[model samples]
Target: MLENYLVRGLLIGIVFGVPAGAVGILSVQRVLSQGAAAGLVTGIGSSVADVFYACIGVFGITIISDFLLKNQHIICMLGCMLVILLGIQCFRKKKVEKPASVSHKKQEDRHQPGTIRYLISCFLSSFAIAITNPATILSFMVVFSMFRIGGNESIGEDIQLVLGIFCGTCFWWLLIAVVVSHIRDRVTDGFYLKLNRIFGILMVLFGAGIGVRAFMV
Candidate 1:
């Protein structure tokens, strides 16, 4: 009973959420550097992906299982693209000067895009990103499926498990945001200039490498 599949899913979310949480530092850094719109885009994009992966793990594993196996190279290519795009964004700098009125917190926070828009877009972006990498779900499916009981099921119990997992995942991201918000000062305007050039070039190189490798294959 203790080693049940539901309990296992709960644990998996807890564990994976940790490193994913850790990288969140970079996510927050990216947000500060990129601006709220971009940061929300990236964050929600990843979050949506995680949610999709969660669904695939529970429901679409069989369908996704085969597609992933057949298109492993394409998957790798997509992953490369995502990483590069983020890197490019991470390093890039804006030329246009935001007015003092816009930059100032009291005015800026209120005048900016609505929170709902930010949230919806963020969810969509993360969801699409996660869908592209079904492996995340597959990995989870493998673990939870391992613990699946071959008897009567409880829908109520399943819901509880899922909610727990999501909360666990959120905990990880929230922790990341906290740490990142702390060091936002260190990431200055000057740093962004050099960072962008380096990451932009490297990201493209990474994409090129993936294409070259796939082409060879």
Candidate 2:
């Protein structure tokens, strides 16, 4: 029974994380611009938010869920504005100069005080963006219902499911970070700049869509 719940949670996590939405684009952009660590940290933030919503779904935390649902419009509008600001920042970013020394660049990517601060910023931004989406909990609830997950279950089983979800989400993000980081060295400055702009535009569109949905609700 625990195994079944774990498997279901894993599937749910992967399904939710696979979408190339704003979070996905931000992950890719961070990997290309910053480093694998940055991308992984960003994804970790998102995974944390997923776990928060998953807990609400699995544990049936009605009060918090209801509050989020009730104020979804305000929350979504704030998220929309933040996302658009981020998009504009990305779009207007100056081109980075390629490091003349590959080995030196690799060394520089290692964690330092400044890098730690940057990673923290990345994590917070992604977390804030992800958590503001009240729809995340709804998605979790719907998927939980489909899997028959949340009724009369042991606390142990619910914990296992949430753990599985966190692991699954982290695994997906790790794969993304590794793959994108591997190719990061080969990408040219011009190509990186172009991708940043394209991703920025996409993120803005995504934010606009979210705003429209907020109004519809």
Candidate 3:
């Protein structure tokens, strides 16, 4: 029974994480520019946020869940705006120039803030976005219902499920970062620039769609 709960959790986690939305694209771009470690760390932050929402769903935090769902229009609008801003920044970012020497590369890295700062920035940003998307909690609820979750399970069962969720999300993000990092050296500067612009356009479209939907209601 415990194993079954864990398996269900893992499957649900992967399903939730698989969408190549704004956050996914951002992580990919970061991997290509910063390195796999940075990207993975950023993704971990997102995964942690996912777990938090999952907890809310499983524990049946009705008050909080209802509030988020009721105001989802505003939340969606704000999230879309934030995503659009990030897209624009990505689009405007200068193409990375290859350093002529290893020493130059090391110096550049030294000039930047440490990994902790980068991870914190990514965590806060991703958490903000994830929390605003009330659909995530809905998804968890649906999946739990499908699995016949009673919300009366023991603490042990919940822990197992949460662990499964964390591992599943980590697995997906690690795959992304590793795959992108492998091709990072091969991708041309122009390709990265184009990628940014493409994602930027996508973000704007997504935001516009949300705005239209919100206003239409």
Candidate 4:
């Protein structure tokens, strides 16, 4: 029972957490009081929350799920507000320097999002921000429910699954932090500001779109 729970949870976590990292780290990287640090702390905090949600799904908290569905419109609206905030921040900054003589291929990638706080703040914001998407919870529910943990998934076995999932999330986050941290040093502040603006505008657009959608609903 223990082994089955461990293995299944491990596989499920790896499958979900790795991809989730791409989304998670990027969000954390966006709002950078210090990019990398923010990514790290927020990522870890979110990882904890992810584990909690996994446990909830495994335990069958249908009521909680139902409640979330009921208030989904509100969630979307909140998400839109965050996006507006993001948009304002981005356009405020200036552009970066030219390419290495304008003949090289260095323009595609600018700021590396080095500030640790930047990334972590993104992560922390994402705890709620990620949830705002609505689908995020469903994704967790679907993934965990597939495994079915223990025999009837006793509490212990369920917990094991959550643990495995947390471990997987950890692996994904650490990998992102390392990658971002490494390249971050090479980028310029101008590039960072530009990226922020682009993301910010896009965020505002998406947010406003969602908010409108909620009203329509």
lDDT per residue for candidate 2 within 1-217, as digits (tens), equals 7888788778877877773678888998998887788889999989999999999988889999999999999999998998888999889987673333246866677576876898899999999989989888989878888878756889988988898889889888899999998999999888888988998999999999889988999
Model 1 lDDT per residue over 145-192, tens place? 655622244665555555556655665565655565555556665655
Error of 1 at 209 (Å): 8.1
* Runs in model 4 lying further than 4 Å from the true structure: 19-35, 93-123, 148-151, 205-217
Strongest candidate by TM-score: 2
Model 4 superposed RMSD (Cα): 7.2
Once model 2 is optimally superposed onto the true structure by TM-score, how far is the C-alpha of residue 11 displaced, in angstroms? 1.8
RMSD of each: 4.9, 2.0, 2.6, 7.2
Ranking by TM-score: 2, 3, 4, 1
Better of 3 and 4 by TM-score: 3
Candidate with better lDDT, 1 vs 3? 3
* Alpha-carbon TM-score of each model against the true structure: 0.65, 0.93, 0.87, 0.72
How far out, in Å, is residue 20 in model 3? Answer: 1.7
RMSD of 3: 2.6
Sum up the clashes in candidate 3: 0
Candidate 1 residues lying further than 4 Å off, grouped into runs, are 1-10, 19-26, 34-41, 94-102, 109-111, 114-123, 145-153, 194-217
**Better TM-score candidate (1, 4):** 4
Report every candidate's CA lDDT. Answer: 0.54, 0.86, 0.76, 0.62
